[model samples]
Target: MLFCDPSMLPCYRSVQCIGYLSVKIHRFMLYTFTFIYSLGV
Candidate 1:
């Protein structure tokens, strides 16, 4: 079994948040690009 140190919880949470935010940003950029492409601009 693997053990997680209590002191590392914050670091883990921050990493999770960064991952989530990056995914959201990527999705937003993809949507915007598609919209602009559809406009032929």
Candidate 2:
């Protein structure tokens, strides 16, 4: 169960957005590393 008061809504939304972007950046880094490794082999 998640509950956010009106005053806290903006802060909560920003946290969620930051978390989503971090996950995406992590996946991109993983792909980049693998591609470089394959080229090096």
Candidate 3:
């Protein structure tokens, strides 16, 4: 069971968080991942 179903774009829209909020959040996650990767290397 998934507690947070972030796979659906409409999820954020349903909450009135705007259309691109998911994309922005995805970008932030990628950036943070890269930062942590570089720090570990």
Candidate 1 vs candidate 2, lDDT winner: 2
Give the per-residue Cα lDDT of candidate 2 at 32: 100
What TM-score does prediction 3 earn? 0.54
Q: Where's the lowest-lDDT run of ten residues in candidate 1?
A: 1-10
Best by lDDT: 2
Most accurate candidate by TM-score: 1
Encode model 3's per-residue lDDT on 1-41: one tens digit a residue: 12234665666545545435676789899999999999999
- Score every model by TM-score: 0.73, 0.71, 0.54
| Per-residue C-alpha lDDT of model 1 across residues 1-41, encoded as one tens digit per residue | 02334456778867766777788899999999999999996
How high is the lDDT of residue 1 in model 2? 9
* TM-score head-to-head 2 vs 3, winner: 2
Query: What lDDT is obtained when candidate 2 is compared to the true structure?
Result: 0.75
lDDT of 2 at 38: 100
lDDT per residue as tens, model 2, 1-41: 03333555687867766777788899999999999999999
Q: How many backbone collisions does model 1 have?
A: 0
lDDT of 1 at 27: 95
